[model samples]
Target chain A: MDSLNSLIDGFGTALTPVNLLWAALGVLLGTAIGVLPGIGPAMAVALLLPVTYGLEPTGAFIMFAGIYYGAMFGGSTTSILLNTPGESAAVVAAMEGHPMAKAGRGPQALAAAAIGHFAGGMIGTVLLVVLAPTVASLAVDIGAPDYFAIMVLAFIAVTSVLGSSRIRGLASLLIGLTIGLVGLDQMTGQQRLTFGSLQLADGVDVVIVAVGLFAIGEALWVAAHLRRSTGEPIPVGRPWLGRDDLRRTWKSWLRGPVIGFPFGAIPAGGAEIPTFLSYVTEKRLSKHREEFGKGAIEGVAGPESAASASAAGTLVSMLTLGLPTTAVAAVMLAAFQQYGIQPGPLLFEREPELVWGLIASLFVGMVLLLALNLPLAPLWAKLLRIPRPYLYAGILFFAAVGAYAVGGEAADLVILLVIGLIGLGMRRYGLPVLPAVIGVILGPAAEQQLRRALQISDGSASGLVDTPFSVTVYGVVLLILAWPLVRKQVTRRMAARR
Target chain B: MTTGTAGPTPGPKRAHWLRDHSELGVSVLLLVLGVLVLTDALTMSVDLTQRGPVGPRTVPLVVGGGLLVIAVLLAADVLRGGRGEAEGGEDIDLAEPADWRTVLLLAGVFLANAVLIGPFGFPVSGALLFWGSAWALGSRHYDRDPLIAAGLSLVTYFVFDSLLGVPLPGGPLMGVV
Candidate 1:
């Protein structure tokens, strides 16, 4: 009953003309940028963050929520038309979407994706409304050991699951942790790895790290391979679905949210796993199974919905427990920190208006995304035609400005350059970049929790493992670490038997 | 493992050997980074505080230790002929030799922006960056390119400075902006 009143008040806040305008603008700009190749939601958010600095916290976050959904919606446009999935989550959409586009069902493919995104987002938002308070209350019961253990699970899951090789991922995570270790320690007020430099004392900014890795690093890597065009994008018409298409799509959309939200709500949630699983499920369940590779409407509908649902799912942990499982969510956490808003159980109590208003704006943003994207997809697709040189150059231009604006320091630009080069090397060597970003964001938080747990237990190492929640979290981490090796052995044995 | 170390041949075999060991750079890079972290942690100044037994040094020590272990393991794996898969599922052609010229050109453009942005300010420096990058990307419409670059840079300068109220150095256009 109390939640219902707050949600009503939230609607009142979000319904303001200025706030609605911000949502509209955010969706428009997000789709425009997201349609461009080599730019994803994380990069878009990181680049646009500086623009939101002057707004009130509520208004700023409303726009951010809009951009988040808008980017997800726009990603499918690129995947279907260009066969260039900007991020891994959209790779599933590309599998059947591009083929649909090739078979002259581009409009239908786009319609399925946009509507699926809408359904998933709306249902996920409702789930968030009902579930967030309960989860946040439960999260409050978890002590520091459990918090520390959860961070360990996040670290292990990201390193082991996202990338092809565990070594590279772990190495990247170590690099991020090292970056996080810089500046003064929160409790003791002593520097760990600042190397006595005044500039280093404040540590590396997450925005700088994000822009360097995603924008500048991506541009540099793409430049190295800028020899040939991938292919001409399939021309798409107005996004429209027939009665038959809608009938086939509705069940998949429902199934997608069911499958996607659980993966996203976990501390270890990433969109990649859920989207792939949704694709496989649809392929196995479809009545027209032979059309799976060729323009299957169910193929685009299910995975796109799953991807968006999982994206919304990531917010559950982010809001309730202050954990970010994806790169974009990491940036969102940084955005929250920028506003001095720490999302956790107390957030709903202390700033009920801000939290509820943000959630309300997510629903508003979804409606805005669906309304804007259904017709503008063909227009947004034109963004793919931008000259590669100018597109990347513009990226660098914004990246430099974004880095410079952080602290108004010249040293930040140099740091961006160095980090960008490191990012380039990591990309060339096939290392996953998300774990490093996650490590940088979560490392300090995890360390603080560990220290707190130890302080309470008089420095006894066993104190960290005493709690059931902590033990279970650590057990999960161990299983995640060992699962790949065990699976490899099992596969090898099967091969030998054959 | 024996295929890499005990065998030598020219042609495709030699190329295969190079590919197999290409990731030595990554393992070596990890090792160097691990040593750097440990050395930095060891040399950091220690100061006691009102906070209890867990000092700031503890986390760094643990992280540095973890890095060293990962480095050693990665090196061993590489030696045992384990190799990372080349990036796939993207539009990139990893098989083609890297086009260093364009990359270096773009790098130079970024460096030039860094050097020029402070002295020349955002508008002038930004336009130069835009034009230079377009050229790097093989766009050679000399007359039209500069015009677009100027328009984009000027528009950005105004929007950020006036509407957003974010201070950007305007160089010669400072007073006008």
Candidate 2:
């Protein structure tokens, strides 16, 4: 009942004209960029961060939230229609959606995807509204050691689970941590790796790193692989959903949110695991399991819903615990810090209007997204028909403009190129980029927490592991780090038996 | 894993051992980089505070240690012949040469932006950038490319400069715009 009242209050803030406009703009821009081959919400939000400097916090965040969910929706359109996944979460969608497109049931796939997005997003948001306060209350009891342990767990889980190879993932994470160390050391106020440059005083901006890596690096990599090629164009099918299609897909849509929400809330658990799990679950449970690789509607619906739901779930964690489960969430956390607002357990109690208003706007944004996606999907599809050259060129242009917009520093452009090359190399070597981004965002905060925990316990080494709660958190981290080795041995014995 | 009848499975002969252990090579390189970073970090003079057990070096040291452990583990895995292939589920085609045109074009775009951004400002430099990228991406329609490029540059100019209030570089041709 308390949640119901506050949700109505949230609606009041979300429905204001200015907030609505911000939401619309975010979704529009999100969809536009999301259709592009390499750009994702993380890059989009990074590009927009400097621009959002002037807007009210609530309005800016409303737009950022819209972009996050909007990209998840838009990413599926490309996956189904063109077999090109603009984001990692959409990779599963592409697997099944493309086959469906080839079978001339692309419209049915699109309908399932759109409906799934709505269902998943709504359910994820509902969980956020209900579960966030409870989680936050628990968080308030956490001390510096506990927080440090949690971060360590997050670092381990994210790098190991997100990619095909855990080694490559850790390497990627190390690179990010190194980059995070580039600025002035926070504790001593001394430069660690600035190389004595005056611009090194403030350290590299998170926006520049994100834009360079995602937008510029992506462009450079694509350019390196560019080829004159063509394929049998997949035609856009009818846009309307048949009643039978709806009946078939609704159950999957409902199930997707339930699966995705918990994954989103867990630290280091991201959309990829939930999406893959959703696909496997749907395949095992479906009455028409045979239809899975042959344009199954459930295949398209379940994963797409789970992906969006997980995205919403990540937002809940970010706003409440100040923890980011994904790359985009990390960047947004940086954005929040830039505004001088440290998001934690007390945020809702401190700024109820901002939190609730943001929640309300998500509901409104989801509605607008469905309207934009369902009827105008062809327009979105036409984005692919545009020459790749023009699209990529536009990305480079924006990259330079975005870099220069922040203080008009020419050196930032140079940094962008350098980082772009680094990004390209990482991609070529199969390294995940998210961990590095995490390191950059959380490095200083982690240092501060470690110092605080130590100060409380004197100079003793045992001080680091003194608290019961902290010890438990570290115990969990150790298990996560060790699980891979255990799993490998088990798998080897199983294979030997086979 | 279904071993499809593509070929004789190469008799499990471990075709191209170097390719299989590429990730191992990468892990070694990362370990070296981590060592280099640690050396650099250690070179800095630290002013210790008496107030706390953990100092400024604690976080970096921990991260560096984690990197070393992970890298060594990865190298061991690679050395043990535990690494998988590219997982294409298909036979490899080795005859294709790398695409160099895109490499040159992307480099050109970055160079042009860096050089021109200060002198010509955001609009003109951005226009060139847009047009060049479009050309690089394989747009053959010359008639439409420049117009689209200029239009995109201008729209970006307005959004960043007017709407967002970001002060984009206006190079030597600043007043002309």
Candidate 3:
């Protein structure tokens, strides 16, 4: 009842004419940029983040709610129509959705995806509402050791689970941690890696790091291998689900959120796994098993819903625990910091209205996204027709503006370009960007927590495992670390026996 | 993922392991960075007044050590013929060789913007960035590109500076706007 009452008040804040207007603008802008061939949700958010610094935090977050879902839908639309997913999460949608587009069932596939996004977002938001407060309250009592353990768990999970090479992920993560270590030590004010430069004293801004890696780095990478030919999205009519389509998709829409929410709530629970899992789950349960890879509407419905639902699940961790499990969530965490808001257990207690209003705005944003996208799906697709040169140039332009806007010094822009090159190197070598991002955001926090724990123990490392929660988390980290080796051994043994 | 499996296949044709495994450069960079971090941490002048058992240097030592270890492991992997698959996207044509010319051109433009933003202000510099990048990316509409770049730069300036109140240096136009 308490949560319900708070949610209703949140609606009161979100339903205002001005707030609704900003939400609509966020959706429009997010989808417009997000629909471009190469831009993903994270880039879309980063691109738009600089300009929104003018707005109040509540309004800005509400707008971000719209922008977040709008970017996701835009990425999905591009994937379905052009087989061009901006990032890995949308790969599942392209698996079946693109095939459907090629088969001239583009409208139906889009309908299923739109509805699926809506259903999953709705259900997941509901779950976030019900579960966030309870989690927050529980997290409030968690001590430094437990917190440190959780951050360590997150570090290992992101490094090990993502990308093809664990070593590469770790390297990227260490690079980010080093960047995090660049600033003066929070406790003692001693510089660790400033290299005697006064500018380096404050360390790199998260906004600059984010913009550099995702936007500038991405633009340069695209520039390095620019193609002559342009990719076009398949032309589509209005998206609508027929009776049979509705019946086939309803269960999947419901099931998708169920599978995705939990995965997204966990550290390094990226959208790829849940979407793929939902796709596999749907295939196993489907009466149209043969159609799983061949443009099945159920395939589109399941994974799209799963992806959207997983996005909400990511919020559960971000809003409650302040640990970002995905790239976009990491950028969103940086955004929270920019707004002078620290998202954690006390966030709800400190800013009840902002938290609840953000949740309610998510619900509002979902409805707005579905309403706008269904009728204007074709319009969004036309964004692909934009010339690639102008598109990438625009990204760089905005990245500069955003980077400069952070501190208004040319220094940030310089840092952006330099880090951007490193980002390019990472992409060239198959280093996943998420671990690097997570490391930059979490490294300092982890160090601080570690220090606090050790201080409490008066230098005994045993304090790290004194808590039951810390012990369990460490156990999970050990399992994650050992799982790959065990799997490799098992596979080798099986091959040898064969 | 790539299947160019970097194991020692014992083929004379691929005997130039160092040349063939160019990705070793990444590990080299990692190594250099590791050394930098370790040296910095070891040399850090921590104050005696520091309270915690773990000072700021402790985390850097661990992170620096991890980086060095990863560098060695990655180098070994590359030597064994393991390759890190380059990322791909819709616009990228991986089959084609990297066009370093364009990348350098874009970087030059970016660097110019950074240098010029202080002297000429955001309007002139940001416009130059847009136009230069478009040209580098193969946009040939010279007549219209500048107009668009200028318009875009001005709009951004107005949005961030005028509307949002971010203090972008206006240079000569400081008094006019």
Provide TM-scores for the models.
0.93, 0.90, 0.95
Regions of candidate 3 where Cα sits further than 4 Å from its true position: A51-53, A489-498, B1-16, B174-177
For residues B58-165, write the lDDT of model 1, one tens digit per residue: 778888888888878877888897776655534466666677788789888888888888888888988998899889978999888999999999999888878888
Name the top lDDT candidate: 3
Q: At residue A27, what lDDT does model 2 achieve? A: 92
Sorted on DockQ, best first, the list reads 3, 1, 2
Q: What is every candidate's C-alpha DockQ against the true complex, given to 2 decimals?
A: 0.55, 0.37, 0.75
Name the lDDT value of residue A440 in candidate 2.
74
Worst-scoring 10-residue span by lDDT in model 2 chain A:
A224-233
Comparing 1 and 2 by lDDT, which wins?
1
In order, the interface RMSDs are 2.0, 4.4, 1.2
| lDDT string, candidate 2, A1-498, tens digits | 776788899899999999999999999988876766667788888777776566778898899989999988888888888776767788888888889888888888888898899899998998888888777877777777777776777677778777777777787777778778777777777676677888877888877888788778776766655544523348885556788888888899999988888788666557878998999999998998988887788888999999889988898778877878887888788788768887877888787888899999999999999999988887888776656676667777777877777668888888888888777767656677777778777777777887887778776657678778678878877888898899999999999999
Worst 10 residues of 3 chain A by lDDT: A46-55
The single-chain TM-score for chain B of candidate 1 is 0.81
- Give the residue spans of candidate 2 off by over 4 A: A230-233, A267-269, A466-469, A489-498, B1-32, B48-51, B64-96
User: Which lDDT tens digits does candidate 1 get at residues A355-411?
Assistant: 888888889899889988999889888888777777778888899888887876667
Per-residue lDDT for A1-498 in model 3, tens only? 899999999999989998888888878876775577778778877766775567788888877767777777777888899888855777889999999999999999999998898998899999999999999998887789988988898799999988888989898999999899998899988977888899999988888888889998899998888888877678999998899999999999999999888988987556889999999999999999888778999999998898888889989998988878888888888889888787888898999999998899888888889998899999988888888999999999989988888888888888999999999988988888878888888888899999999999999999899988789889999999999999999999999999
For model 2, report DockQ.
0.37
Steric clash pairs (candidate 1): none
The interface root mean square deviation of candidate 2 comes to: 4.4
